[model samples]
Each structure stands twice: as structure tokens, then as C-alpha cells.
Target: MVEAVHTAVAGRVRYRVAGLKRAPELKKLLEFRLSRTPDVTHVSASDLTGTLLVCFNSGNTVEGLAGRIAAIVEEYRSHGGGLAPGDNPGKEAGWLDTVPGLTPAYEAIKGLFALGGEQPREPWHTLTPEEVLARFGTSPDTGLSAGRAREHLTTYGANLLPESQPRSSWEIFFGQFQSLPVALLGAAAGLSLLTGGVVDALLIAGVVVANAFIGYKTESEAEKTIRSLQTQVRPTALVIRDGRMSEISAAEVTLGDLVVLRPGTYVPADARVVAAHHLSVDESALTGESLAVTKTEQPLVGVDLPLGDRRNMAFLGTTVVRGRGSGVVVATGLRTAFGGISTQVREVGETKTPLQGRLDSFSRVIALAVLGVTALVVLLGLLAGEAPRTGSEYARRFTWARAAEL
Candidate 1:
């Protein structure tokens, strides 16, 4: 059995339910609440088991709907009308309180009021579908079909993954020139000078500094480019508050806000259009098509429609190119299509660049060569007749012997 709640502010609907034989009274309470809600225009109730499916028009607001639902739940609890069969062995218990243990259906409803009407903020940092599958050990395509993947990529721009911020200029500057090669060169120079090879030490030190400078420049430039891209792709959205439309940063938007969308505007969140007049949007970000899609104010019947096919809805990061519309936000940040996509993208591991790979290999080769040269020099000197006499008497004896032989 299922009971559904459609919140206007969120533009998303969630379901709650109890099984046919498990919690019949809970289903009855949900039906009673559905009957009392004036905004609920359509309700399909099961005669045998008391399952209720309720739908609200686009004109409803999320806060308004949530308030009404909360009141109904509270009323049922006070009057002992929300008791489910076998909830308690001898006495009646609040069905809403115990619903989480009964099934996953009431979890959404329970979560709605758990924090005293303060909704959970969508996580700004999210992973892409690919990432979710990879992390959970599921097939990459299991929950993310090809069409869904494409939608996510298009809507969120390169998948809904949070970008890594580049290191600050100071960090980059300090980190540059600090490499194994440079360290080794410094060590070699210090050792050579201590052993009375000042000229060789200076030469090695110069080479090390020069190599450090080159590597530092390359790495710094790469970091700057990445930072620039991140700034360029950041999006802003238009929203309506207190009956006035204004532009604001997307991060500031919350659930239940009304966002205004027009040509060239990006949809800031997941929303259901309450007002649309010949509204056409470029959903290619989520749909992977260059063609603009016509949007309507009609209700969507199925939850299975791919984000691209949900004509009644708009998603974050999608552009409005050809029409005008206003929608009530249902999901923001991580709950939106962009957020979901971002979650997936986060799972893809970063791979080393070709240049990086080549440089690593080159560094290894140079290190091996230096070690081999040092080893050969030390080994040859030891093997040849360059051994020093141990004590003064030994040296004097060797000299006398040599002189006598001469």
C-alpha cells in the first residue's frame, strides 16, 4: 500500500505506506488527512486495504502543504486515530512514531517534521551517477541507464561532481621548486664541498635550481588554468521572493522558493512549473540535445519519465532559450538533477596526464643514473691501489720499503 505527498515548494513528491495487513490504521489516517486537504484534488483510495494516493495541483506551496500535513498528523496522534493494528500489545500507540520500524514508506514523512520543520539542506558537494555506482559496488549502468547518464551530464555540465579548488598562489609558489631532483642536487653539492670539491658542488647546485625553476613554472600554469575554468562555469539563478523577482547566487536558494526563468536563464533547481507561456527550455545539459524543449503546466503522470521527458519540470543548470516560466522549487543543490550528476562525477578517479607520466619516468631514470655513477666511482676507487696506510708507523715502513726497493 502507498500514500504519497506532493509538496509544491519542492516540486517533488514522496511516498509513505504500510502493508495491507501490517498497519491498516496508519493507512486510514493518511486517507483521512488526504480527504481534509483542500489542495488535494485527486485521491485514489483502496477499498480493501485503505491505501491512498493523493495529488495536488501546481498552485500549492510546499510550506502550506507541509503545515497542513503536520497538523493532520498531530491531530491524529492526539485523538489516538493514528494507531496501527498490533502497534502495541495492549494499548494504542502513535502510528507515525512507529512507522519507520514498520516500513520505509513513512521515513520521508517522519523526516519532514523530525527537525521541527527545518528541512534538510541538500549537500552542495555531490557525486555523479557513475561515482555512486562505483562506490556502492553496483554495476555502473545498474541504477544509471544510458539516457539518465546523458541527462545528468548535460544538465549539470560535465556531470554533477564538485570541483576541486586549486591551491592558493602562495601555496603554489612555496611548493614549486621542491622536488626530489632539487633535494638530491643540494645534498650532492653539500657533500662535494665538504670533501674539498667546491667547483663540482657549485655546478651541481646550479643545475638543480634550473630544473626546479622549469618544473615550478609548468605546474603553476596548470593550476591557474584549472582555477579559471571553475570560475567560468559557476552559474547564477533568478528567483522571486516577497513577490519581487531578483537575481541571486544559486547557493542562497532554499526549498519552497519561487524561481523565475526566461530565455538564456539557467534553471536553478528542480521545480514544477506553475506558470508557463510557450515556455521552451534548452535541456540539452540534461537531455544531450541541442534542440530546445517545449514545457507545459500539465501534471506528469508517471515517476518513470526520464528527466528529459518530464515536460512539466525544470532542472538546475538547464538553460531557458525560447520562452518564459515560473516554478516552485522542489529540490535544490544535491537533490536536483545537477546534484545527482555531480555525485556521480565525484566517483571517477583522476588519471595522470601524459606529461606527468613522462616526467615521472624521466625523474626515475635520472635518479638511477646518478646512483649508478656514484656507486661506480666509489667501487673503482676501492678496487684500485688507492688504499691509504692505516697508522704513522705503517706509512713510514711502506715509504722505507719503497725507498729500499728503488
Candidate 2:
């Protein structure tokens, strides 16, 4: 029994209880329950113990995830079409009404944490490209889902490349020289040189290089700014692990990790403060309000409070200007409010600069003009007798009959 408890807490479990006479029925019931819970990615049943263990991916909120599991347990108990003691099982010690509107799975887990007064931790330091690829089972050579590939590219840049992966600003800058636009520009310059327009060719080459340089610089600066923001804010969060207070890296946090916040430290992740001592945070990044907003440890009156009005919540990337508090980390990368903003920025994409648009329009116009001028020049020269000069000279040299004989 003690071993089972440890297994349940340390990992995950699904089970069915039945008399020895009903063992076959129990197996059938477990199978039916497992099949119904499609979210369970893996399931293993033990005939000896009549226990089923299910594993699921982290796709939904903790509360939702747990609710799904609870539902499965209840369904298994009621599989014989009759109510049993376990059918309407008493609520778990650490369970709450699933957060409204969340998936059953997310609600279940989050509710567990809420009732237990547990919080989430920050993530480990930002994952490198290789680590991310390994986690997702992506290969440098193998193809990936378009959406996933794009996400990886946006996050890691040339680090996705296996060799000569660009890690610094300068390497990234130089990498731009190898793109299709640069190649096209080179072709244009070569054409110009062959046509004996050395000056024009050189000018065109210069423009292409300059444009590449500007684009590289802008991207580099944006990355540097984001890194600077990350560096400047040093947030110390108090975390309880194994029932002991410990100070740890703010980024190496995970969902449901408890955090302690104090005046003057930034909130490292999205959290609901379970305890507060006159807590307040400067949420200018999220709300555009310049003042320090007060917070409380009480359950929020409304579930749908706008981020700015979530008086019981503290968000990632915000400053705690006054008071002390402890909260649970509910979300992290691509999940936190700041992470959401980052995702949105990536989704909107980088627009071409005004100069780039103008240059593109100008180039198209010039190309058409050159083609038209070349045609017009050939036609004019033909009309001026320049094309038939040899024929005319032969005609002057001999009569029609003499030219034919020759």
C-alpha cells in the first residue's frame, strides 16, 4: 500500500477495484475506461494488482488534465452500470472545482495544486537549439511539421543548422550574404559586367550588400535588446522543495512550483499568490499602467479579470515594487503573458522596411523600362536602314541578274 502511494505521487496511475470473482469484469472495465480517455497517450494494466497506469502528455491546464483522469476513474467504477463506493469517489484531499472553461485535464491538476497550496517553478535556462530539437525529436536532416519547424527557426535562428551554427551577432550577420536575394543580385551584376557597364554593375553590387547589412543590423539589435531585458531583471523567488525552503534559478522553474516574492524583485513567472503581505507589482509591461498595482492572496472574485485587473495574480516579467508574497508558477515559456506576447510578435512576422518596399518597386519599374528601351532601340535601328545596310550595298554593287549568277 505504501509502495502504491509512492508510485501514485511520483508518477501516474489508473486503477479498478473488484472482487477476485469479478477479475475478468475488472479488466474489461479498465480497458473500456482507457479507450474512452483518448488523452491518455500510454496505458499499462497489471492483472495481478488490477491496477492501470496511464501516462499523458502536457497539453492542457493542470486542472483540466486531472479532471480527465478523475472522470476516467469514475467511469471505470461505474462500468457495470451500477453505482459503487468508488463510483462517486470522495474528492481527493487536494482537489478543487476545475478552473472554469479549462479542459478537464488542466482543471484537475491545477485544482489539485490550488487545494494543496502548491505553486509552479520557473524553467531551466533557455534551451539551446540542440536541446529543443532533441526534446521534439527533430533532426537537422529530417523534415518537420511546417508549424514546428517555423517555430524552431524563429526561436533559434541559424542554430538549427548542424554545422557552422551561428551563435553570435557577427556570424548571423555574415550568414545573410548567402541568401537567394544576394545570389540574384550577384547574377544581375554579372550580366551588367558582360554588357560592358562596369560602373552600373559595381553600384548595383554595393546596393545589395548595403541592404543586407542594414537588415542584419536591425535583427541583431532586436535580439540584443531582448537579451538585455532578460539580464537586467534579477528576480529572487523563494521555493519550497521537499518541504524545505530553497533559493534557485528563477528560469529553472516548472508548473506548480511554489515561489516566494518580495519587494523590489521581479515576478519570474505567471502565478497566483497564495499568501501576501501587502503585495504590489509594477505591471507596466502588461497593462501599460505606470503604477504599482496592489495584489492579494485571496481567490479572485472574478475568473475573467483582465490581466491588468487580476489583483490576486502576479505575472511573469513584472516588477514587485513593494511588499512580500508567495505564489505558484502556473505557466512559463510560450505560456506566460510575456511568452504570449513573444509568440504574437513571432506570428505577426517581420514587415519590410519602407526603404525596402520603395527599392523593390523601383527595381521592378527599372527592369521593365530597360526591357522596353532595348526593344525600342532595336526597332528604331532597323527602321533607320541600319539592319539592311549589307543587303543595300550588295544591291548597289550589281544588278539583280548578276547578283543571282554570283
Candidate 3:
């Protein structure tokens, strides 16, 4: 039930529903339902704040609105289609977590962070080839001069997956303990030890160790496979450097260089097409979509278009499945659209998978619950005069030798 333990108003009314916190689906449902409510000017729900904030028409009473909210919550719970996704979800599994660079989750997480970038940059696809070239201070015919290319190369770094923040064996092992439930388990273990429950503490510690060890082993192997994949041959690209067409390692392709794309060749960097000879790219590797997206050199008119709709631009790492095109490299390396994109390498390392983000959020909820319950249990035990009797008060007649005996 959605009970409002607290309500306050300062233009927007806040309904504090502690139950909604940590439940992403519930938050979404509440926001969706409340947004359509009559006289409501704005509705916002935050899982982090555990509150439903609504700005209704000044004429409507807060109590009346909250009543409707409560009804909506109750009705949904009483209905058949109200269940959150995977209410029958399997046990938590990190065994299948992305190995960093070569998975769909890798792309998804990158897109999430990019879409949430601090300041969404203006779309490059809106500008014509001449404007795009002018913006980068380079030319289509001559490309970047050798000096300018070297300068941009230094600034943007290599056209490669950054090796920054490569987690160590120890880091991976300890990451298992980074969750909230594990933290609660640790606290419970400490309390058990302090209360002279040596056996209990040992058991709790063992569970924590076993969990971490298993996660460590699994993630270790996954990352090891990633490392092996990284060692494979780096692709090469044909580029015009200082007005001379030269073949270079894809990693050597820098910003503003003119890259010639042919069928079967992977797009080495995110580029704005200057010329297209009936180009159609297999963007499946990058977009997880069709093998054929027709490319165009003409400017596309749209606002925040999806990756697939940006026909005027080519993404890094996607393949040219048919025809040929030449583009001016706009962004290389981590800044490319293949995921893990930003203006800097640090942000790339900091980006987490959606699964990881959700898990972390859920863990916070579990930890809070554990803390509250632990405090309550202690309070009740103390009230009942069952304060823990440690070393001095232990008696052979009273104490059980085995934990199971208790």
C-alpha cells in the first residue's frame, strides 16, 4: 500500500512514500499515473528521494490528490498486470556481467552516459560538409596538414579502447563486497562478534568470503578473455594526410583526417561523410540494428536523432557492408560513437553498465532495510532485558556448544 507517512507543500506537494524508494518500476508507475491526473501541473517521482512530488492546480486540495494516488497504488496491486518485471527473477548473477569492451551492454551503458552527458553537444549532422570542415578547421581535399594532425593526435589520444582503470585481481575480488547487502552482512557479523556469538560471526564471514571468491573468479576469467581479445590485430584505414593518400593503422587515424571507406572495411572513427558513393553501412556491431543503413553526405534535419537516423555521419567500428564513402574524422578513440564515448578517457572508465547501476541502487535499499531492522531488533531485545551477556555472564548450563543447538 502507498501510505504517505509525511506530506508537505511549497508550491509542489511532496508525498513521502518510503516503499516507493528503490523500486524503479513503482516509481515509474506512480509518475505515469499521477502525470495524467487532472489539475496536476507537474509530476515527478524519484527513487533516490523516495517521494512523489506533484504540482497540482492551486484549487485542488492536497489531501484529495493524495487519496487518489493511494487508490491508484492499491488498484494496481489488486490487479493482474501490476507486477514489476522479473518479480520471479532468478538469483543475482554477476557471472554474465559484460567483460568491458566487446558486449552489447558495453554499447548500452555507453549510450546511457553519452545521452546523459553534462552538456549535450549540438548535433553535427545538421551542418553541411563545408560547415563541418570549417568547424574542425580542416579541408576535404588536403585533409589535416601533418603538423595539425600531430597536434590533434596529441590532444585526442589514440584511436583505441583506453586501458585506463583496468581493474586488478584484487580490485575485482573486493568489488563483490562493494554492494549494500554485503555491507549489512559485515555489520551483522561485527555485532555478532561483539555479542560473543563467535560461531555466528564466523559463519557470516565465511558467507561473505565465499561470495566474494566466486564473483572474483568469474569476473577474473571474463576480463581475461577481454584482454586476449584486445591483443588481436588492429585494423588499418586508408586516409589522406597532408593532401597525400596513405594507408595507416586505424589507431593512427586522427581527428580531421579524410578517411576513405570501402565495402567490408570497418569505420575507424566517428566521421561526417563528405562524399558517398551509394553508401550503406552494417551498423549492427555498433547500433545492434540493420546491416544496411544508407549513408548520405547531405545534412540531416532533426533534433537529437537516434544513432540509426543520423544518416549523414558514420560511427566508429561499424562496417561498410556495401558501396564506398569518404569521411572527415570528427571524433576518434573513446569519443567515437561505438560506446565509451566522452571528450576524455576518465569518463569512459567511469561509465558503468545499466545492470550495475540498477544493482547498486537496489543494494542501497537492502542496506537501509538491514540497518533499520538491526536497530529495531536491538531496541526490542534491550527493552525485554535481554541485553547480550558476553564473556563474564556466559554459563555452561545456559550456553549451547553448537550454533544449531540454540
Summarize candidate 2's per-residue lDDT along 1-406 as a digit string, tens digits.
Answer: 1012223442354444333122433443444344345455444444445445555555433345446545544544444423434654764432223212333322222222211222223221232334333544443233233344233323322110011122587776776666444554566566656655566567766777787788788878876556444333333455654455654435344454556778777677776666678888999988899999988765545545578877767888798888887765556555677766876777786677999788767755655554465456557768986653553332222222111211
Clashes of each: 20, 35, 0
Per-candidate TM equals 0.43, 0.41, 0.48
Model 3 Cα lDDT, one tens digit per residue, 1-406: 4445444654567777645655555554565556556677666676655667777786677778878778756654554224455763562432113222222212222223212222124578998999878877787888888777666665556566655445888889888887667766676667667767677678877878997899999998887567545433346688887789865557667778889889988788889998999999988877789669999999988878898899989998788988887998877666677646434445444778899899788767765654565557657878999865654233211222222111
For 335-401, candidate 1 gives per-residue lDDT tens digits of 6787777777776755679997898688767766666665565467569965434433333322222
- How good is model 3 by TM-score? 0.48
In model 1, which range of ten residues has the least summed lDDT?
397-406
Ranking by TM-score: 3, 1, 2
Worst 10 residues of 3 by lDDT: 397-406
lDDT per prediction?
0.54, 0.52, 0.68
* TM-score of candidate 2 against the unseen true structure: 0.41
Q: Give the winner by lDDT.
A: 3
Cα lDDT, model 2, residue 208: 70
Q: What is candidate 2's local distance difference test score? A: 0.52
Which residue ranges in model 1 land beyond 4 Å of their true spot? 1-165, 168-170, 173-195, 213-236, 275-278, 284-296, 299-306, 343-351, 362-406
